[model samples]
Target: MSEFFQQPPRAGNRFHTDPSLRLLTQWHLPDAIYEQAEPQLERMGALADEVMGALAEQAETNEPEHTPYDAWGRRIDRVRIDDSWRELMRIGQREGLVAIPHERAYGAHSRVVQAGLVHLYDPASAVADCPLVMTDGAVTLLQEHDPGLAEHYNPRLTAREGAWTAGQWMTEKEGGSDVSGTSTVASQDADGRWRLYGTKWFTSAVTADMALALARAETSAGEDQGLSLFLLELRNADDTWNGLEIRRLKDKLGTRALPTAEIDLVGAAAVPVGSLGGGVRKLAGLLNVARFWAAIGGPAGVGQLLALARDYAGKREAFGSLLRDNPIHRRWLARISADYEAMLALNFETAAQLGQSENGGPKELARLLAPLNKLACARQAAQTGSELLESFGGAGYVEDTGIPRLFRNLHVHCIWEGTTSVLAHDVVRALGAPENAEAFADDICRRLKNLTTAGTARVKQKIESELDVLMPLVNDPREEEARRIGWGMARIYQGVLLAEFAEWKKSAFDDDAGFATAELFCRRGLVDEPFPETDADTAGRMAFGS
Candidate 1:
């Protein structure tokens, strides 16, 4: 026989295979909502598997190209992407990945269903979700600030055929996260039209048809009355470039498939979207939506890693036995699996709260949970991806193995929308509101009320005790202290969420994995029973000398 190596088979239909995700949707969503979303979920699941399995190799190899000018030196600033990328976008729009929530076709359950679909679709889309995040944010902002703009742009943004995406341009060279330092100036033209003249330091999806930006309106006030939000169309009605010049595409550590650029705006015609001085207030809607999207990406990436690692375990063998049969290997796999489950529980619960807020439920809890969930899930994804790579041995580190991308893609979630420190401060600010803090505490208690097992109850008590200590510090927490508290709060929240799901699964699906997962997560994450450190020789032999 010829010498050969065995490899794991490609993933099958993701929706059908993932029992936890299916149970999560059933447990969190209302019956009517689940029924309405079922068909769409199935379609997205199949598409996701196809994208990650058959088309993933080519898609990963394809990097977006920036064409700055036409052959005749006309300023085009075109970005060329692969056909596979375009097809993925078309599939996403046709599935109403971004539109369903905005349109509210399913009433109060729209956001929940939309979030679930995005969770399934994000991992295989090769960062196409980046533009979708901004597009969804723009839709939400426009719908509230200027209904006229929403009416004109919503169709284009949501359409599967002839779709047009939107971008967000906010960061300037001087102001990385501080919009108060915005120096972009807007002035009135001879025709009494608003025009923007400034440079945007970091603009993602630069080839987008339009962008929502922040520029200070030139006023005589001395107090620097905050930046105003404006909508700038990238092209004129005649298909010519507007008064915008793309400086160059950004060289990023990851997300290379998505084109990001720096651009200078000169006489670029714009229209004010919201109140002149209420720019920060108006941006709340976009920030909320984008943060939720950011939170979901982590779980989705971890799901991909778990799938790859699990498949490889059953196929690869050593010492005349399969890796899946080894207790040590199984322990590592179990830890990652439990972590992923706990993260999904937290993320979906937050999604449920967000959906409920749209129907007159408490909005404050959603506010607090969005940043917390994003920060925690992003951290989990990075750590889990690293371990999963190690679990696959040396093959995981290779590009062709398709494992490295998960790790690279996951790191972006830590920095995108907001960093851990930025979000930690936001959490502190949210908790400052008395009503918000009360609502959060009430929700956590409600989830824990049904814990029947003594072990689960003990875990719940520990989490509550931690919350008691953390809530008092919210009012006067220093930056570093606030970050530390934020991490603790996230662990408590995830533990509580996992316990709730465990109880539900025990009753409904007769599944014990959920309970086991919850127990493991609480013991490790909340109780702080971290794995012990080993000697250098042992670590070296395990990590490399094998």
Candidate 2:
């Protein structure tokens, strides 16, 4: 008897192969920008398959090495990363992954184009997207604050040749979100130059050429509001760490290929970006950009798993036939596709808002949308990423198959920008403003009307009911229920956006995907809360394992 063996799945050009991505462009982007973006997206997709995909695998195997000393035991404190990792940065640089929006080549469509490229590049990036996110954030802040810093850093950050990445240093033992208690104190030297002295509890992308950090100025007497943003290079002319000590690299669960470290600033030479006071406010631009990146990352991560799962279904066999032919597997794949497609719509919607904001559109919408996008997409990705992993059966559990990384890396999205709960609170706070709440509700209602006009009345009604219930909760939300409030808003946002696009798809392309996705999002995306019947006593016991 012959032994049965499963064949490995194959993936083609990520951008070119995915209909939803193309569909989104057609739905959201201008024809002129779409025409220009399509070819570049094609190139990125090919590179994603032909080049970056292999690099992602290699980076996984050749994890970043943190060498604390040299060959002769010189205390260099070097974080040596894979050449493949280096190439990934170069690929992003050459491809204008972060530069697209700043370049303004496509005008207001720039962010949409950029989102498309990054969405395609992410799966193959092995979390190299981490540095790119920080770098993009750095670019946004520098451009808005200091002219000289922007000139010096923006070119290097956006370089097509020898590009550079930047780190985000904010966390410390004192707090993660609470910057008021940060112990990293900034003091000026005799020359009036700034320097930072304290420990950075969790500094990501430490191997980057530069970083934007938060430190409380020594001269400030106030509490949280006294924090300042400082720009610092990673190395000196002699290739030594610039007043920075890499205490140790973190042993993280995922993103092992991306170097994350705990650093002690030994008088790290720095330059203040803007006014010494309100550093957190100045850094908010960077945070917004980073949050957007995190939001897109959700779709990127899950989309990767979906591709692999769909491919695997065609190749792997079950009791009697290929998994692709199995009704259960096909149904699961359909739901995955629906969820993935719906989230993709939300990503581009947020991206479009960002693009418009650059060209003088409503900035407040983007602010509210950022938190909504991050919270919604992160939860969806986390939930579905794990399910998609199970679609591979035991093969997903194995490290070698490269499927687990999709899910493993997703955990950070929920925590990185802000935990789902943190974002929920932000949403609640943002919605506290009557104008913001009104604008948010108006946007959803408008989008839902499009689907309603397209004859998806049940879909619109379901979402309308959700909004009716959800609106009151966010308007006057409890601390514990903040997550539910945020998620409810995000889900409604996704559903309406999906419905709008499905309307376009139905009329323009006559495709069922948009209708299917819209219906699924309304049905599965919106919910009344988890186990409302279960008492707090039962829920507490279930959670505590008591």
lDDT of each: 0.80, 0.83
lDDT per residue (tens digit) for residues 120-229 in model 2: 88888988888888888889889898888898889989877878889989888988877777888898777778889999988887888999888887643323436788
| Candidate 2 least-lDDT 10 residues | 217-226
By TM-score, how accurate is candidate 2? 0.94
lDDT of 1 by residue, 1-546 (tens): 899877753545657766767778888777887897899899888888865444555666888787888899987877777777767767778888778887788887787788778878888888888888899889988888889989999889977677788999888999787777888888776666778899999988786889998888864333344578999889899977688888888888777677788899988998888667788788888998888999899888888778777777789998888989999999888988888887887788788878778677879888888899998998888888888879778877788777787678889999888898889888888877778878876777777776777546767776777666766665455554667767877888888888877777777767667767777887764523322577668877887986
Regions of model 2 farther than 4 Å from truth: 1-3, 71-73, 220-225, 452-454, 525-527, 530-546
Q: Ten consecutive residues with minimal summed lDDT in candidate 1?
A: 523-532
- RMSD of candidate 2 to the true fold? 2.5
